[model samples]
Target: MSTTTQNRLESRYAGITLEGYPHALSAWFIVALRFVMGGMILFAGLGKLAFVSGEPFDASGFLVHGVDPASPVSGLYAAMASNVALMEIINVVVPITQVLIGVALITGAFVRLAALGGAMQMAMFYLGGWEGQWLAAFDSTLIYALVFLALGAFAAGRIAGLDRYIEQIDVGGEPLVERFPTLRYLLG
Candidate 1:
């Protein structure tokens, strides 16, 4: 490529050239994804619970609309939406889970676990809701799933998150977090 073209391509963004430093965007992207996804989940749950706006929120709408009549699991989601007993249980669980996951991702605490949980939820949604168009409209759920897993695998929370502080604690000559194998696996 011509020097002028190269220079133009390497133009400074936010004062740093991204020419040979693609990962520079990694940190920013992760933080942005974390906040955006976390905020969306948090606000969604809070809205459902009417924690801030006093507007009524219910999972019934999601349950009702999530499934396509032609989809294989449509009967299941439909049944869950229609059945009072199951709906009663799910109504409380879904919102609380979303809120907790949102808090974890936002605070960068137990982010791996949160992301994994979020991924599982998204996968379930995909299985039940997507039916046929897995790539067009419902791909975002899998995207969420992958991003969450990537954040966990990279321990992105430690970059600018509470994990940095939490990881510093030592107990009995070992990090307090080391005591929990699951946490170590997740955070690492």
Candidate 2:
């Protein structure tokens, strides 16, 4: 090698670094992906649980058909209209989910599980988007969901977080992790 190349390589530890400065581009993407989606979920959960208003939603009226007061689930938004208490509880839980998942992403703990949950939540939200309902308001969330699934597929957690710890447990080569091929790429 040339003197300049040799000197540069030596200075850079032969380009070896655990900071994921190189060769782990996808891993870093996953981390960012988790943060963005987690934030949205957290916000949504908190918002729904916190808000309380008796007036029927203009959007809800558009999503569901006419209602018969006698029928609990019918009439525009009758389902939601009847479940004020449940909605409040959901609001609280949703925020908690957002905060916890956000922590997991930021700290790199159980990242796969957190990503999976994030993906599922995104799918549910995306699917629930009907007839220009709140779905349209948050249609962009679908992209985040797809990103989480990709992160899970690549085992982003192992590269960045507690996956290393999980892998250390002796279960005959960690059968649970072994079942997940992405575990192979996880940091050990």
**Candidate 2: worst-modelled 10 consecutive residues by lDDT:** 1-10
Question: For candidate 1, lDDT tens digit of each residue in 90-184?
Answer: 87787788899899889888778788878787776766667566455547777777877877766767867777667667877877587654566
lDDT of 2 by residue, 16-80 (tens): 65332233344466667656665656555444433433332232342244333333334434556
TM-score of 1: 0.75
**In terms of TM-score, which candidate is strongest?**
1
Clashes of 1: 0
True-vs-predicted CA distance for residue 98, candidate 2, Å: 1.3
- Spell out the clash pairs found in candidate 1: none
For model 1, the local distance difference test gives: 0.73
Candidate closest to the true structure, highest lDDT: 1
* Per-prediction TM-score: 0.75, 0.53
Looking at model 1, report the run of 10 residues with the lowest lDDT sum: 1-10
Residue 11 local lDDT, model 1: 51
